[model samples]
Target: MPQPVIYTHQLTRKFGDFVAVDAITFEVQPGEIFGFLGANGAGKTTAMRILCGLLSPTSGQANVAGFDVYRQNEEIKKQIGYMSQKFSLYENLTVRENIQFFGGIYGLSRQELKDKTNVLIDRLGLHNEANKLVGALPLGWKQKISFSVAILHRPKIVFLDEPTGGVDPITRRQFWDMIYEAAHDGITVFVTTHYMDEAEYCDRVSIMVDGAIAALDTPAGLKKQFNATNMDEVFLQLARGAKRGD
Candidate 1:
């Protein structure tokens, strides 16, 4: 059996009296694409932040790459890459410069950074734009570059928070191809998105509502479980049920 790359036990996070993530538990298998589905304010981002070691869980445990989120945060950080909903690259830097800067931070040697930067530039089809300032790139290209920078270190797990948000449908499809390529290379992808169609691309998905998981399964399984025709219908049915219970 494949081992889980991510594991959480009763993971909970609270802000004063408001519970942002309430005792949720799930595991992401190695090399799998795990989609986290939720409406706005459903705590999907909160849970991801906790898993990425950006936020501490108020209670319970989270382990990424075998490092405990609370006690071994530094190890976890070294083993994982995270791309937030917001673009994180330095707009003032050239595309190549941005790659070098991030590679440097990951402790890649100068020579190694140069080699990897060249490889990434070619792979992402940014060779012509390598010298262009990142600020001048289009939204789709900027998103692609941001994603490239996030994985420069080749971490064991990569967390993407709404990585394809606001892009055109074609761009989003291309972005998912990149994600699949990563997963095929043995990298575990944990993603959060509002797009039901994208959720169908995941190997498995977990839908959060009001700080808890309302459903967890493959997209087909979820559709079957809800007696729905598709992921959109499945999501709608479960989301409505969750709202009614709230």
Candidate 2:
């Protein structure tokens, strides 16, 4: 059987009287792309933060890459990579410079960094733009570079928070292809997105509403269970059910 890369049991987070995530339980298997779906303020980010060891859960347990999030945060950090919704590259730096900077921070040697940079630049088709300033690159290119930098350390799990936000449809598709390639190479991807079409690309998906998981299944399973033709309908129905306190 495949081992779980992420496991959470009744994981909850609270801020004062407001609960950000409420007793959420789930597991993501190795090499799977697990999509986390939710409306804004639906606790998706909060849950992801906890899983990434950026924040502590208020209660329950979370194990990432076989390390307890609360007790082995440092180990967890080393095993996971995170790409936020916002592109997080230095706009003033060139593409190669950005790669070098990130790789250095991850303790990579100069020779190793140079080799990886060359491979990445070629793989991402950024050979011609390697010397171009990141700020001058198109939004799609910047996003792609940011994603590449995030995984520079070759982490076991990569968490992406809306990694493909405002790009064109073609760019979005390309980004997903990159994600699939990463997963195929044995990296587990956990992501959050509002795009139903993108959600369908995931091997499994979990929908959050009002700080709890309202639905969890493969895309086909969700569609069948909700008797919906698509993920959007399933999401809408689940969201409405949550609002009605059902």
Runs off by more than 4 Å, candidate 2: 244-246
- Candidate 1 local Cα displacement, residue 65, angstroms: 0.8
- Collision pairs in model 1: none
Candidate 1 deviant stretches above 4 angstroms: 243-246
Q: What is the C-alpha RMSD of each candidate to the true structure, in Å?
A: 1.6, 1.8
Please report, as a residue range, the 10-residue window in candidate 2 with the lowest summed lDDT: 237-246
- TM-score per prediction, in order, is 0.96, 0.96
- Model 2, residue 237: C-alpha shift (Å): 0.6
Tens-digit lDDT string for candidate 1 (93-121): 99999999989998889889989999999
lDDT of 2 by residue, 149-238 (tens): 988889999999999989999999999999999999999999998789999999999999999999999999999999999999999998
- Which whole-number lDDT from 0 to 100 does residue 180 have in model 1? 97
Candidate 1, residue 147: Cα displacement in angstroms equals 1.0
